[model samples]
Target: MNPVSQSRQSAIFGKRKEPHTVIIARGDQIRHFTVRPWIAAVAGSALAAVAVGYLLATSYLVLRDDLIGATVARQARMQQAYEDRISSLRAQVDRITSRQLLDQQMMEEKVGELISRQQELAARQAKIGPLLDSAADLKTSSDETIPTPAPRPDVRAGLDATTHSTLAGFLPDLRAGSANLSAADNADRLFVSINQSLRSIEADQMDRLKSMTEKAYRTADAISNALEGAGLSIAKGYGTSSVGGPLVPLDQSMQFDAVVDELDEALTALDTVKEKARQLPISNPAPGKQVSSTFGVRKDPLLGTPALHAGMDFRATTGSSVRASGAGTVVTAGWNGGYGRMVEIDHGKGLTTRYAHMSKILVAVGDKIEAGDIVGRVGSTGRSTGPHLHYEVRRDGKPLNPLTFIKAGKAIAGLI
Candidate 1:
């Protein structure tokens, strides 16, 4: 056959197609089957679809697990951050609360101190305000003069009236006027101002107390000097006494009163001591008279031997008036063994004075005599060798130098 004719016949008759065959056997049985290409292709497509489905399902499951784990980790990290933030905030809140509490406590303490100061100032004012007013009203030009107190209905009334007067001038009412401030701030300022005022009052009180103390000390010193000049002693005060009782705490106000009372007592003692000094035998018996003999051991003019002379001798004309050294009563007015006419005066406190060698005795027994009063007349009598006045001072029967008494009297010549 020609090639071209064969090719045509192949195309028309489908001679290029091949037959597909399959064989199956089971035990001794056998079977034969025929297969087509289209059928095989269909079967292959179905197998491929199943494999793709399985791969997709596996990928979905893997990806889902990974996403879930990632999500859980992220959420845990966020939760930790949130917890940390919460903890920090809680700590901050605790700190703030503590700070506020401390501030409040401090404010309360300041307020309490201010209140206590106010109470103290009020108490002190109540105690001394009226006295101050009276003193001011009765002030004198001389510092040594004491003024009389004025009568008042009540000291508290004036104190209350004038308590805040200066405060008003110095620190104006913080709440009374319009202010660009919060209420709390305003109130704090007012508390501060009140505290300052209390401090000022305390300072003033201290100053006054210092001045009074100085004055009291000066007065007491003057009195002591005067008393000492007159050979008088002052009594000891309350320093040595003890009291058995519940111990009461004294504040500044009470302490001030105690000081004032002690000063007053000291002044009273001075006055009393001064009065006592006036009654002591510390005056000159024969003023302006010349001394002939001093009180001590000396050579006796008549015996020509050393002897104890217990009295002072004043050289005066015979019949010259002899005066009493101090106020007292005559204990004896008669002739003594070696004294001739003698006069003994008792000045109390176991003290006595004697006028011996007197030409005439003017004071009788039991007679009252005063300083400068005539007790006798100067004369040369008994053991005396010349015209003279014998003066003797004795304490508890023991003789003292008459010159000492004369010197003490001279020291306080002008004073009481």
Candidate 2:
């Protein structure tokens, strides 16, 4: 059969169609068959695949950018939180550091004043040495001129190599009854340690102040010892003796006040500081609140008649906790006349505080109560009106207005 006829028969009989092809011819009769349809389709699919791959790359880059932006935002928020906390802590540290600086400054002023005073004392002590020596020579010693014949052999009684220094006056008997203060060596109040610290600092005022105080004490002691060795009392005398002391004339005798003037001033300043520390308020005091009724006067709440109130009436709730105003041992507890179920605390500064009209007592007579400790519940009790705690602050067997101390304490509390 012809090739064209066979091809037509295959088409007619439903045989698979042959692939379409194209041919290209060049000069000299060289020809090439075209690519098959399936091959063309595969090339088209590869081109499409390349295009999709390009889209996918672009999408990935966009997604990566978004992820980076999100991460950056999150980091920024976290950093802000940490920075805020750091700033707050820094502020607190600054405040505490300031307080320490103030305390340091105060201590430094005191120490400087003390050192100045000590120098004055030392000067007077210096003057007294020569004065006392001269006075002793004038009063107790007589100048004797030894008759000098040219080295008489009989006169030389045992005097060979060492010549005895001229005997002056006997040392004064100044050591009598004396109570040496252990703190006499201390020239200034010890500075409290620096409470807050920074990461790095060249110098802190607190440390400097503390050092100065220590130096003042040691220097004073050394000076005192030197004066003592020079045959003169640091003062006219340290302690009193039963024997009268004007053995020499008044004009020549060393003045007692001048030698220890610095010491006296220093002592006065120290006392001022000590008193301030003592008056410092403790934590929540029962007597700190405003007084509804004072201890002594006014008409009775129930009877509406003038009556003597044994203790101050502090108006508070029934369950409000009553605190001890200072650290002390409880000396009295339980019921007493007009002070029902009261607690009395004896703080060693010759001061005592009493809390009365308690609903419940938590401390006994021998118990040690620190300042701001809950000693009992406040309530109305024997010979009293409604629920109110009776509080009293006493000093040296006399009642004082607790308001003044309480107000001062409240002022301090506000600082904290």
TM-score of each: 0.47, 0.34
Q: What lDDT would candidate 1 get against the real structure? A: 0.71
What is the clash count of model 2?
0
Query: What does candidate 1's lDDT look like per residue over 1-416, in tens digits?
Result: 99999988987898565558889999999997888888888989999999999999999897998889999999999999999999999999999778655545555565566556656666666665554543341223454232222221121322222333322344466656636664335546656876665666566666654555455445445545654654555553534588698888888667777755654554455456455665677788888899989999999989999999998999999999999988899999989978889999998888899999899988789998888899989988889889999899998998888887777767656434
Highest TM-score against the true fold, candidate? 1
lDDT score, candidate 2, position 50: 99
Q: Give the lDDT of residue 207 in candidate 2.
A: 33
What candidate 1 gets wrong by more than 4 Å, as runs, is 1-141, 145-260, 413-416
lDDT of 2 by residue, 1-416 (tens): 99999989989899665776676767778676767778989999999999999999999887998989999999999999999999999999999778655544554454454344445445544643443332231222222111111211121222221211110011112112212412211212121111111101112222322333333334333333432342212332222357565565423123334323433433333334333333332334664455678656778777889976654667788988899876788999899877888899887656788888889899988998777889999988876777888877776667766655564444434222
